[model samples]
Target: MATPAHLNRVALRGRGARSNATGRFETYRSESFDDGWTEADEAARPLTTIIQPMKSRTIIARNDSPDIGFNASINPYRGCEHGCIYCYARPAHAYLGLSPGLDFESRLFFKPEAGRLLERELSKPGYKPQVIHIGGDTDPYQPQEKSLRVTRAVIETLARFSHPFTIITKSALITRDLDVLGPLGKAGLVRAAVSVTTLDRKLARSMEPRAATPERRIDAIRQLAAAGVPVTVMFAPSIPSLNDHEMEAVLQRAAEAGATSAGYVALRLPLEIGDLFQHWLRTDHPDRAKRVMSLVRQMRGGAVNNSEWGQRMTGEGPVAEVMNQRFLIARRKSGLDAPSQRMDVGSFKVPARAGDQLTLF
Candidate 1:
């Protein structure tokens, strides 16, 4: 297991018995193999590279989850580059025949025609307006967004139709579209939430390698607030023995930055994500890895995770309770308990096609 030079900052490397697979990388379990084993008997595989392409159809996706807020959502991209070790979205990449590890960050997908598809969907005869969520599955403003501008185009379409929507992201790039978002938000048709995991730069870098810095995200919240856009600060995926201690601090900072609401969720490792998260812990924070996993198991009811609808978001146990208490206290002290106001959909009006003729009075 050779460590990639770029990853030396984390001081970790992959080490496991390999198989003789040719097309894709495969992992095998090894339990006390015979001593003096040599590399000749190991299997070799080719590394997969990034496959960038555009999704052609169906821009809007519906959500039926009981705990989530929005019913309709849009994802401008498929995979995220902000390699957050605890990200549950990592498992989604496995469906693309890619590793949930490094491949999740390198390989990416974009919806180049998102704006056109959205316009068509909204223009349907029976189409109804709801609070459409952006970046529900992946960050709409990830690094590639600077060049692709898919998210920007989608926002433009929503604005043209006077539609309401919400956005969640850790990127400061959302500020780039304030010209479009600010007015809609002032009209009570749009809101944004910025995710701030930790104030510690080193921890942030290791946990979410490509996300905007904590300070920059704070600035984004402030900027949005100044523009009259409602901003909610999210301390999401509260990793138990890792970033939990900073929950209160994060709330305070968000409040100081003019955020009006706050929320959090315990770290979730579902499906293939469980293995990837464990591997990350053992690699980066070997010393605290055991303690962290132990606490996580306690909250997860003696396992790595619990996916039941009620228990999945916040987990269950004393540790989870303490975290909830801390979050509540901070939120209250910061005056961040304002009830979320529903965005107005009654005012929605479908725009006429560019070539459509207007009737004279």
Candidate 2:
């Protein structure tokens, strides 16, 4: 448990801790320094989590952003417990009147009514079925999911309504819902993608705190495939000068684990994320911090990130092109370039509401 030079009192990371850096939004959007009780005292402070219930009116969210493929999505949680330092969704916490730093992960909000809301929306007249993307912002399968079961309830709703949906998660908890996903897969109403940032256990722990181990993720992929679910592997947000080198290896391992399709997104640092990530880089890998930022800027068009639709996911430069080319080549060679399995939209059928026909099918 080492501390940063400036944050000598604060722990930079825990075992598998990825977000030890101070929250940028905590400055009240300003900067101030205090030299209280040396570094030892700061490291002694403990980390705790507080879960709150969110009363959400709707479960289905419409997205017009051309950046993502899906139009609608459902996230059962407001914040994530997986404290991945590079989570692009971190800044969203600011909208909740909270800091996007540590608060984004430690302070979580769960939507208890997600399942009912989803069912109600599905019962609406003329409601067309689309592949509702789950885990859009915060991971619906995060640790809290085990106890709250909000995500499970949403999936159950989709299954009952014959709604097509997709899942994106880094947790192995999804395997627990094989009962739900298995049927959806057979009906062609569900697909899933698991994210593996790095195959290296140590790095994986450091980069994504609280997520299942890399081995567990691969095992989850195997389990999903065994259950006949269409599984894809995602090497999301490849960090420059760090896990980027492991792209080929990650693809190979995932393919071996029964993943038929794969995709990736270059690291994205919008708003407060840039500051939080830069601080982590300097603190953990100080020697390579400067070099990493340099490469990131080169790929991001002289900025730490690019929010442009076309350039945000994949940057526009020689370096970015190289990464993309490498990925495509690896995918092709690994037989991951096969046509992606599309969710069966035609199978979507509206189900009866509470008072409607008992046989909604």
Candidate 3:
């Protein structure tokens, strides 16, 4: 899908429908022509919907990185249905022989057994609990989750075992598991972070087409906070020229919406994401595309991305420093710099094996 040529004149509306594919999720684009009108039939050219399928195994994925918070994580599904053009995980689909463009959002994978596998792993005698991050690599609450409920099952298992975990997502669907997350938060076993890239509904639609509307995401934050869930707002992958300007506004709104803490990451276009994001910028925001790339290069030491551990997340140079400073100031002003309450791992309760029941006295 090409970025609209008149992005400056474009005003986004949240009226588009979801995709209809069997195994993936999608949101169709709704365009209004230059004449300031959209025909009735033109309003519904494409129908987007979520698709899902089951997977055989799901368990722990280990990553040793100084930059990331959690060393271990779990993804209930592969290929997020959110269809964010700037997603850093898009390249992953290439390994599956899928296009990082529309195909990435249209093709999906699910690990239905994730909850069972997590139980088995947590039950092992040698298993030690550390905060397990969900939606670390791909969103746990992508659209397909509505049907598969794999993510909810994982949360249920974690709740059952009192395992500590964190979920980061852009979808309001996270609200659906409030039954599980609410109590877990009270027990200090869970925290949830909602990603808000841009507050502008139009920008959000073009940038993260398949995720929930910005208003809905804020509502999710409010609901989580009301339920006693410690909620954090994440302005992740802050594309320099495109959405960077909204940093302070996003943080402020999140604070108003009950976000206690907030964080932001500079856009990192690693591997295929570089090409994919460039394609998106050119297609959607042509006027600012060059400037955006220039600023990204300035931050990345004259490259579109830097893969080094410490430098990758924040990047380098004047542009990055300015972004960091802006975020720090905004975060401090909004009273969002306070540390989040840590999830407790000591309270884990391991379930017994199937045949281990003892006779009642």
RMSD vs true structure, all candidates: 5.1, 3.2, 6.4
Give the per-residue lDDT of model 1 (tens digit) for 1-361.
Answer: 2233323332222211011111123354222232444243231332333547675778999978998888899999887877677777767776666656666766788888999999899998888898999988889999899988999999999999999999999999999999998999899999999999999998888788778989999999999999999999999989878998898899999999999999999999887667667766776788898999999999999999999988898989999888888888989998899998889998888887779898796
TM-score of 2: 0.91
Best by lDDT: 2
In order, candidate lDDTs are 0.81, 0.83, 0.79
- CA deviation > 4 Å runs, candidate 3: 1-58, 353-355, 358-361
TM-score of 3: 0.85
Ranking of all predicted structures according to TM-score, beginning with the best and ending with the worst: 2, 1, 3
lDDT of 3 by residue, 270-345 (tens): 8767766776677678899999999999999888889999999899988899999999999999989998776798
Residues 46-83, candidate 2: write the lDDT tens digits.
55678999898888999899888889999899878888
> What TM-score does each of the candidates earn?
0.88, 0.91, 0.85
Better of 2 and 3 by lDDT: 2
Q: Pick the candidate with the highest TM-score.
A: 2
Worst 10 residues of 2 by lDDT: 8-17
